[model samples]
Target: MSTTERPRILVVGGGYVGLYAAKRIMKKMRYGEATVTVVDPRSYMTYQPFLPEVAAGSISPRHVVVPLRRVLPKAEVLTGRVTTIDQDRKVAVVTPLVGEAYELPFDYLVIALGAVSRTFPIPGLAEQGIGMKGVEEGIGLRNHVLEQLDKAESTTDENVRRKALTFVFVGGGFAGAETIGEVEDMARDAAKYYSTIKREDMRFILVDAADKILPEVGPKLGTWGKEHLESRGIEIYLNTSMDSCVDGHVVLKNGLEVDSNTIVWTAGVKPNPALARYGLPLGPRGHVDTAPTLQVQGTDYIWAAGDNAQVPDVASRKAGVENAWCPPNAQHALRQAKVLGDNVVSGMRGFPQKEYEHSNKGAVAGLGLHKGVAMIVMGKMKIKLKGRLAWYMHRGYHGMAMPTWNRKIRVFADWTLGMFLKREVVALGALETPREEFYEAAKPAPAPAAAAAPAQKAKAS
Candidate 1:
């Protein structure tokens, strides 16, 4: 930024796409070819697939995030946000964590702003629903769930106990299914320690508008998953959406209603709303439109990928599918990022750009510790797995897919230790407001004059 002489590459939103794309570009470019700069609100990139484990207390929150600065040492990492972009002038306005907004000029730009949690305007959702988008939310969810158990155990009133014991999860996809599965497992284990609370006393309900759960894994497996969860006493209402959840009262379209203190929303995600402010070509769903080569439409210097970009899936098209597009998942994001980086380098050097094309490899889902489902597609051959073996597939795939070697080793270590140690079920709900106790102790007490004024006035009367 100090000098406009050297070419600059700016990557916005340091998530999976931004982090991997920046690393790829830095690795490919020669010395002094171009400078790479990354900007995001957080200084770390979170491995989102591990969020479920974090929420279940299977993994520490810190290990799930990769420090952007440590990973991208050669690149300029700015902890802030890009408020607006004037692509006509090739300038972006950046607002740091604590500073005046400034404009940054870049020769090339990569939009990896990613997506945010998608939610409906359901009643009381904003106040009561919990999300699993980030590490903080995951940690908060863990504490809140365990705290609910405490509330159920300590309460004497039957209404309060029942309300505290009821758990509701909205959505049937990977996040909702996995979160409820792991959390239910954790609660089942934690019940052993509580004298009054038992696993049979708790009620878990999963509500989704779809006809089936885990549709990504096909109908047969999805049905199996539903049955498996139901056998464990989970109430799943498929094709049933939540009508309202006001004042801890949950009403479903199917006429079933319940009072619950916990309501989780993991329905879906939409592209970042900031994409509209960038003055770029967007798809119907508000994602940046990009070519197969990953360059933003109608522009050579700008590129986009991951959940924010509507990149055409060439492999699917080649396979005789029309209007095919890549799904917004970590698998595609990681692969698209490398291709985007290569295309950016090629564009800089006037070389031919390579088109992005990748076929579906497979899918895996973990139900709990030793339960899961996996479908592996190898060319024309398909392999299906379930139970403990499929659980291994889930762990193996995501464990290796984790960002860096440092992280991979640490995650594996956590799992190894988990096998030998007791599960940590203690709820640290105080983390939500860590400074509350300090503030209470450190705040100035009421003045003696203020305390004595009421007594003195009464004496005068």
Candidate 2:
């Protein structure tokens, strides 16, 4: 029988869930038992946890992303978006990068659409706010931050220098705190290369509406992280939020205002709104509703697990917690994907499905090169660490957790090389628009006669 004649497993969204789930399903299923198709807008899966390192120039952007086609050679990978799902027809509408939409029939479906950066309608935010949700944004932020230093070092005007030197970051979560910490460390090092710029000349402000930062690491470590950042001459504004960043003039809800050219927004994320079109049962917060078995509620053949699925925390419930849901993090997403993929294969073979259950394994947050906080939880015991030790834990966990030995080795190599080599602080901002220079040099030259005509006309007059 041709490939189309076999049962099809459709996995949507090539993120943490989609990549791992497809890998597991391919490994477990018998040869010729089914065909697996993974569809996503990008051809690679970005390991989001390393985004801060990418932004800080610690890890090469290429190392953090895994090419889908290369890794899943046995499965069919489509670079596109699944626009709609018609459950009644068991068909999904796929719109490729450059083609007409087509219907793909499938016997089983996996929804791992993931989440997008959540934003608000504050004035001028759409124009000035930068996000840290993807690899591109992380790279852009790195260059943008460095370019600000260049602007400050070369400009003579005090106001311009001040505006260029002021960097404002909103949200005190891991993304925000870690980004600011890494960036501040970068800027401090970068300042040594400038004659006029010093660490004191640059201002790093971290603002959040919450009472503390790094809430994932517990309160004690959170407080320690805050105090540590403050000791570095960085400004911390808690219990406050940004009101406006109109034209780079940042105004806060607490009535503080400052002019800054760089404003990063890393508040949080929401489930991909596209989930609405799939006609699946969604939870109160727009996440796909799923049972503990990692299968979508009311649907036997459909499964979802990731940031986009509201899967009950069976482990938490088993520990006597009520209404506990798995938090959307790499720890949970990675584990759930394996279970989800196995369940998919079992369901196909008419076997029993295993319920997904995993308790919190604590959390780790790296503040900068040698600074971090961690909380390790094991069977009713919680151990906390701070400073260099915590930083090592943060790196060690993420390094091993990185998908595939290929990526894990590359990432660890980068860290190892960093130990021997001087920190690379150069900003390749031009990478953002690599063609602009070529276009300037290669565009057709203006006609000499046309250029002279204006002067000739003046002389004639």
Candidate 3:
């Protein structure tokens, strides 16, 4: 590394904010003044909003992720994790996917590591619960659900069948609610092909610790959503928590217990703990604290955004709140990234940096294919929508916001083709170990009868 070379800008985590921020910076920078590098464990950026549809077989898992290399052609993309950042030394310890650790010195840094699923030390949760945070998890959940149907159809034991058919979701947020609804709809449709498992035989339960779900949408729509899910035979357990899910047996705090093979955990997420190792200034909740301009406090060269940053919300000023922080969501992440990117260039060029401010646009959630709830805020008025129309709006908004044009077209194509094609419900449970069955069957057996007879004749002669 030459000291006289171009100033290096290192962006950590190739998530929604990292990808877009790097792209925005690269687009703004002129020929070779600074070098931008993005580091993440994955080479693709997952469009997480469509994960529920992917799990439900509405979209191909491949279509829901945007490849970083394709989108950031100008920036050097490194597939790795940043183990630690020495702010005083201005170096990041990066461990590549298949190599030894190396020190990456940077003139500027962007902390966009994002958040991880918040989990508790409950018994059997680590072993039994599944999450819907990534593309692989979405695909696994899809296969697991289909495999449950197969198990229920083939098994003659009533207890085993009952256990296989019951599915429990431990969160009532958008991820949990949308996932359960889509999966339930998929399972119901798949029952048509099964001779033994009927739609009514399967059970879907959604549990949340809060009094209401979809708090991003106001109270009225949230209440409507709870009622809507309950009317469809989906049990809603609000203001309750799961006591234990030991060995696929879920015990709720309300004294309700059930045996379920599939347990999806989407309760919530906390900032990635890896950020703390970087020695940056973090808030009480473990998120990097940033100024209103999206710059890391007390640092002129480092910036942070996305779920990992506590960016103050300037838009909340109308409500008489001062320095209100922004919430961690896709909408905020996307906008914050753009501002952070521009601010980076502004800092580099010695220009005035702009402040970050955006009011809540409300939220929209899809319950299933044609069901949803939305609350859109326009100035002083807040409008609520539900049912099929809201569902269309939900899909339309996310479909357009699905990132790159390549992925946008692919996602829309998946939705378009879904109208004419039948949903695929085949479970490739053995996908992880394709050769296990073959290897077991091909193991050497005892000597065959003909070989044994030949040996015996030779001995007798």
Top TM-score hit:
1
lDDT comparison, 1 vs 2, better candidate:
2
lDDT of 1 by residue, 42-97 (tens): 99999998898998889899999999999999899988999999888889999999
lDDT of each: 0.93, 0.94, 0.91
Instruction: Write the candidate numbers in order of decreasing lDDT.
Output: 2, 1, 3
**Candidate 2, residue 271: lDDT:** 98
Q: Clashing residue pairs, candidate 1?
A: none
Each prediction's RMSD to truth: 1.9, 2.5, 3.0
TM-score ranking from best candidate downward: 1, 2, 3
Deviating ranges (above 4 Å) for candidate 1: 1-4, 448-451, 454-461
The residue ranges of model 2 lying beyond 4 angstroms of the native Cα positions read 1-3, 449-461
lDDT of 3 by residue, 340-410 (tens): 99999999998988999999998999998899998888999988999999999899999988998888899
Ranked by lDDT, the better of candidates 1 and 3 is 1
Q: Using lDDT as the measure, which candidate wins?
A: 2
TM-score pick, better of 1 and 2: 1
